[model samples]
Target: MCNLIGHALQQALTRRGFIAGSAVGASLIAPMMCSAVAGDDELDTRIEIAQSSGDTASSRTRLLLLGTAGGPTWWPNSDQCGISSAVAVGDAYYLVDCGEGVGKRLQQALLPANSRVMSANLRALFLTHLHSDHTVDYPNLLLFGLFTGLDRPASPLKVFGPGRRGQVAPVFSLPGSSSPTAPIISPDNPTPGTKDMTGYIYQAFATDLNDRMRDNGKRSLEALVEVHDIDIPQIAGFKSPNETPAPPMEPFRVFEDDRVRVSAILVAHAPVWPAFAYRFDSEDGSIVFSGDTARSENLIKLAKGADILVHEVIVTRWIHGLFPAPRSVAEEGLMQHLLGAHTPVEEVGGIAEAAGVKKLVLSHIVPGNATREQLSPAGKGFSGELVIGRDLMQIGTGQAAAPARKG
Candidate 1:
């Protein structure tokens, strides 16, 4: 009787294209079926629903997840891209990071890609750190914005991030190389901060910028971008790479406009000092982004009373399961680095609890394409609204606080 019931159910699902010949086939078919059901109109409706729930759609701030994968490497046939997000307030948008493939993702989010209004509305980009995964699309975003009709920003496009870390020890030595114990080489001066990096990027694109200006009558890209290097107060135990120590870890304002006021705090993503977590406050509500960090009290404090706390998370269980038990020295070292730099999923709940945040949205998720069952272990302690972030998910920041919906 059980076999007969199972067969009937399978047949029903197969007819609906939600399943195929076997369970393995079903897994593939299910997503396709879901895509078919949720067409572009459905996606727009989802966004509209979230936007319309509050006092007025125009007054509410919307959070859009552009990418949700954890690391720099994008696996073949993966649904998500790297970690990036956008906060939309009224007509303008503020990007959080420019992870891999962010330009395409942004085009999808802001439809009618050639619309001058849409392109120009991309006001500022705030970077949490200088990790390759997070900044992979920096060039793409900077160049493509012009082609998309972003002529001149209201103000120079502002980019904010932590200052550079001084030279540090190398993580690993090349295989078969002599002097494996040699320390990493460092220049006489400290590492370049965000402002210097921005200048470098501009200079790197000098030829392109020049040609575009002369041929297309375009303005200089350098005239459009401005970078700010945040110097947060050093935590008692922590040291910054700057020659002079930073002031303190208090909530310091980074940017402000009529729509939102942004503040930042230093979070611990060691070996990469001066990592930041940002808080955005508007009349509607507040949202905190816990950029990339391990367990951090500073992050908790920054997120305190926030309407939404978007935190990065890693599941150690899944990570361990990815490799065989008798690990090599290199594998062990990699594991140690990952474990130390990222927040464990189990601890995420505690941080949310301590912060008293209303909603916890997990992004930069390690082991991309993780299922809810796999992520459940992380939510053991806290009971606030938990959301497993996905690319193109949109959430409304308002008193009504509509549940996040896939875009």
Candidate 2:
């Protein structure tokens, strides 16, 4: 049995193109060999033990959950806020989604407010999809950042998100008509891509932006913001506006700088085509954000061997309790839409397990006040460390210290 196991290990290393003489190859092979010999159950047990002991290596990257509520609305008395998060590497911060009140949350996180420090350090913004809940505070982030700190940003603020989806005909057209005469309508008109959307924001705030520039002697906010529309490479059953296919199952590098590299993959968020999950890789470690999705295999491929998986999770059973029983057809449809788009807590664990992430942090939590008993369903199959996210909670990328809970 020992000899057979050794043979299998040798074959696996060879298949992976690992050189026997290379120290890096040997380091990689050692873990695989142990896993193969101990088997999955033993390996999982070891992982659980290590997690329980808080065995995490120290690194420079940090994740802060600015808000953890699943939807756009924030309750008056609840501690939960709308969805937004920031991943900081060294002194630079990258924002993912800008839900309502994110600016205040940033202030609460000790990020410089109305200061030059904020302008210089708040590096870039990444939008997972164009949901209102994810983008409600975009204008605030863009405008507020200018005056909250010392001075306006010297460089253009970078924004990235998936390109617009192609227009589709309305479900209901004029009865007995072969073609609908009225122009095709969507949730938003012109199906503006991210670039266009950025421009529109600039135009919408032109008067105020100009006043800030001329009156306050500030830089042109319009000129200082640059937007990039991510043209999601087409995959089977996932079509982008361009209709061109990229290499299958490969992560697309969307942004890179001296501090970190950002890669994205198309995730399954049906009826909202071209939704993306982003992975940020820095010197400390890699962190992946699932934005909002439902059982996306591409996300698993993108997140393989990642240090932390910050995924959006919802408990469908609790969803009904949040709203009155679907009395109207529209209400029922809304519930169905919610059910179809978000990932269940249990499925979130399975995705983390499949990706082999070290820590699973659940954010954008549905029914914000979910109890431990309510969330236990997610732990049924996952053995890695699990963190129930809350607003202003800071998680270090490397060391497995207890998350610093603030606010």
Candidate 3:
């Protein structure tokens, strides 16, 4: 249910996972789906929406839901953008994932307070996995941000994401049926991680990047952003990505600075090894992104005691409805695959409770058009506040940093 890519041969490989965001994907379930993803509800309880743009220009931290829709499918009639969120600590903000409409959403949500310049204060970007939805706009951010304010920052935007999946996932097969042949795409470097992906983008857009530098005197792409592949901890149970995507492990530090300390742990977004859940701890409080996972112990451990847990939730009922009863074995297998990778609305509450977070905000919502009634159950077991995430909504974390006192 957690949020939400593009084309070419490498794009074809990226789109290999369940994908959409096209005219065809928009009509994938045109019959049963209808409405926007804002969820049919007004603000209630701990939900914080910025009344004036000035509210977010603070020393305290805040969580901005830039694009809440999950999945590659572009749902019909839903204006919900793909899955992207930001943890803003004062002027500088860190981004988690780059789903569809991320650039535009960033403009709408952050530009006003940020001098209307893209990447003016974009401190960093952390990708949970290599899913098309999570990374579709990544290329755009690099390719486009340079023209905006990418080089305006004092330092490069440090990027972190999962490393390569050494082995390809096993193909699915129905009972008593032979496994289908799985063709490897780009076998020479079949599984590229964040660093490799960034490098490839540089190569793919070399002509354009060169034009900017040679013609307009812009800084090179490498000077604008620093990218890294998050190394998987070699845990005892972990064998290979296909064998065990995420094994029991402790949260490890990935990056840090004066403002926030970032830590990460492997979460189970199966077949996509080294999927991660990240935690950002600041003087204000802790905010954690569950990324896209199906209730993994590693995620729970990573999110323990966080102030705000921005977790992903799928409407389990909607998933079931996708493949109605009397489904063929292949249909049934597909249904199980969807269910296995995501946490359901009914289950996320318990996971949040287990993590002892003070507030649980659901994002990367599946079906984009899911109703509040269908999502309310997420609060049943959760003692903390529940926010049915909406695109561009703002929720402050911890106390708003006090204004400076006059002498």
Candidate 4:
């Protein structure tokens, strides 16, 4: 029986497949019923919590977890590898990454369409990079927000990000523009189907935006979703920069309101250049987010002594052990590429330790082997508090909470 169990474990290690984080607990187990959604449906009208005060003894800051997508495969129970960290600097919500199903998740989290993340009253969105997992829900944010009436305020959705801002120009309402398309995986449209998702998305809302403009006797809807494409440099050797200034990379700073200051630094996740690690600073405390990266000094530098480090990781030892056997070489190569592009668990712990973060939350998890038990081995390397993230699992700002025991 022991030998048979060993064989099954061997097979799991050998399977070559992409993994992603998903909601396994309440998100899946919880009924899909939207009872809370039925009531008033006002996003900003929900519960309120006191925020931590910052510098000058005048302002306060808070953060809310929206979407939790990680792992190599998106769980049927959860969405893909997308996470939105919304920070409240006094009275605004600044979104970190808008991934697939983010709209629905935000609704579930009850962050109303146009309401600020905190009680203060501001709205902003920031994208860490343009990976499919990170930005797949880009258009949905606009379409859904408008339909739900969240985009009706005077303030346009303030967007910030790294690189090629509007270079591919989002499919706009204006005619004569080339509409954006996506590959279709259905047999009806046989020729390697490329369906225009954005076009369809806009079509769904074209009537509303137009009709509203006519009713209001204005050029357009009361609130228009604005896209500000920030440019992140696509450079080589950013991992080991030999020179100062680093070619004018603009770190993300949400506000200069000295009460609460947020900053970002670029980290390595090649061939996706200019990945970011963001830091949130208030007088009382601070938190850092490692957007999506492998091990790098830049992240360590960015996270230095922050309250929390929300990081992404891939299991290396598990992958190496699993793929060195009989299988397609092409599959093996792809698997190796993924492994190379992400942080191993040991390195995740090391990053946290070196950065001196008060606590460590391991996110964007790519579990090489099934079961959380297999992942505990990584804790041997990281002594600080470690959390194996699950979708919608809320965590508080830094006061060390011990990691859950391995199953």
**RMSD to truth, every model:** 9.1, 12.9, 9.0, 14.0
Off by over 4 Å in 3: 1-59, 113-116, 152-154, 325-330, 404-407
TM of each candidate vs. truth: 0.79, 0.76, 0.84, 0.62
Model 2 lDDT-worst window of ten: 1-10
> Which candidate would rank higher by TM-score, 1 or 3?
3
Worst 10 residues of 1 by lDDT: 1-10
For model 1, residues 181-287, the per-residue Cα lDDT tens digits are 54433354346667867777778888898888899888877777777888665456544343222224678889998888999987777666667889999878988
TM-score, cand. 2 = 0.76
Clashes of 1: 2
Show how many residue pairs clash in every candidate, following the order shown: 2, 9, 8, 19
lDDT of 3 by residue, 88-140 (tens): 88777899999998887676665433343667789899999999989999999
- Candidate 4: tens digits of C-alpha lDDT, residues 1-407: 00001111111111110011123323332332122112232322431211211111122343444555554346553332366656544444566777766665554433433444321233656666656677677677764565554444566666555542112212222244455454544334322101233334456678876775677443442245445544444545433322321333445454445445768777665545445677777665776888887776877887888776778777676677667767464555466556766777767777888888765765566651223444444454555665544334334453222333447
User: Using alpha carbons, what is the TM-score of model 1?
Assistant: 0.79
lDDT of 2 by residue, 86-204 (tens): 88776678999988768766665643223334556777899998878888888888887777642434557789986766664233233464653446544566466677677778889
Largest lDDT belongs to which candidate?
Answer: 3
Model 4 misplaced regions, further than 4 Å:
1-62, 71-73, 76-81, 89-91, 111-122, 165-223, 231-259, 317-333, 368-370, 398-407
lDDT of 4 at 397: 50
Quantify all predictions' global Cα lDDT against the true fold.
0.69, 0.68, 0.77, 0.51
- Output the worst ten-in-a-row residue range by lDDT, candidate 3: 3-12
Query: Sort by TM-score, best first: what order?
Result: 3, 1, 2, 4
Q: Identify the candidate with maximal TM-score.
A: 3
